[model samples]
Target: MVRGIRGAITVINNEEQEIIKATERLIKEIIILNQVAPENVAHIIITVTEDLNATFPAKALRSFEGWTYVPVMCSREIPVPKSLPKCIRVMLTVNTSSAQADIKHVYLEDAIHLRPDLQLTDRHL
Candidate 1:
């Protein structure tokens, strides 16, 4: 079976380091929460808001020891009017046995506003 785990986090700046850090943190939390193994991840799609263009968000995954072979693509998010800024969103497509409803979607920092219905008690990770 195939399933997608969605995640998003906001960065304090458009700088490469901040974007990379936020992306890494977001994906790490999603992996921990979902108990996902890198080997099972089919691919990852990372999208950044229009205001953030320092670097590709996919660069964050390079530091992961087991994710060297994982396929990843980075792109710009559609610029909607009055949308969240400095945000990075990720869609991790994986081969999993879990049902769709069992998948946990992570939204951290200001990005939580993008999906309040999916937010947990914690503010950010």
Candidate 2:
């Protein structure tokens, strides 16, 4: 079976360093919570607000301890009025047999408020 993990993080600013840090933190947490293997990760699609194009969030994964070849891409999130600013969201598709109830979804920092029903696991950052 295949499962999808969704997560998001808020950037303190539009700075490259902040985006990279936040993105790395979110991806690491998602991977850990799901016990995801690099090979099992089909691909990761990420979206950032238009205000955040200075850096690609996928680069953060490249700097991860043992993840250097994971396929990652970035795009602009749908712009809407009164939406969260400096937000980067990711949808990860991975091969797994686990049921939805056994899967973990992460919403960090301000993003936590996005999914109040999902319990948070320990954060890697």
Candidate 3:
């Protein structure tokens, strides 16, 4: 079955390095938590807050050898009032045996505030 795993993270600045680091961290957590292999990933969609245009989050994954064959795309998030800033979010679709409720969705840094109900542990990269 195809399952979707979601994750988000907040960056400290709009610099290319910061954006890349934060996006890498977020994707790593998502992959680890979901136990997803690159071969199993169908596609990944990433979005960043309008304030962050320094680089595309997908660009960071290029350095990961496993991601070379994975399909990935990036776009700007909808500008919602009072939304978290410097946030990068991703929805990764993968072929998995896990149930929807069993999937782990990661939210890190200030982006954790965006999904209080997930009650994820406080972890920083």
Candidate 4:
């Protein structure tokens, strides 16, 4: 059985290093929390806010995960008025036997503010 997990974060800058670091951390947490195997991951789609076009977050993730052949895509978020800026969002489709509720959805750093009902302190990864 495969499932998808959603995670988001807000970057302080458009620097590649910052995006890479934040994405890696969030992705790692998602994988660890869900106990997902690398082979189970079908594909990943990452979107960065319009203000961040300096680099593709997927590229950094591919490098960090050492997944040279994985299907990854990057796109720009819709420039909606009054939307969260400097945000990097990820939608991961993975093959797993875990329930939806068991899948950990991460909202890191300032992005935590998006889901105030979630217990950020419950993050174990």
**lDDT of model 3, residue 97:** 96
**Whole-model lDDT per candidate:** 0.91, 0.86, 0.89, 0.82
Clashing pairs in 1: none
lDDT of 4 by residue, 1-125 (tens): 77888889998988988888888888888878777666778999999898887777886666655566668899888899988899999989998877877777889988887777654577775
- Candidate 2 lands at a TM-score of 0.92
Higher-lDDT candidate of 2 and 4: 2
Q: By TM-score, who's the top model here?
A: 1
Ranked candidates, highest lDDT first: 1, 3, 2, 4
Answer with 2 or 3, whichever has the higher lDDT: 3
**For candidate 3, lDDT tens digit of each residue in 32-112?**
777889999999999999999988889989888778999999989999999899899999999999999988899888988
Worst 10 residues of 3 by lDDT: 116-125
Give the top-scoring candidate (lDDT). Answer: 1
Score candidate 1 by TM-score against the native.
0.94
Off by over 4 Å in 3: 122-125
Looking at model 3, residue 22 earns an lDDT score of: 87
TM-score of candidate 4 against the unseen true structure: 0.89
Per-residue lDDT of model 2, residues 11-76, tens digit only: 878988999999988888888888898889888999998889889888888777656677888999
Q: Model 2, stretches more than 4 Å misplaced?
A: 121-124
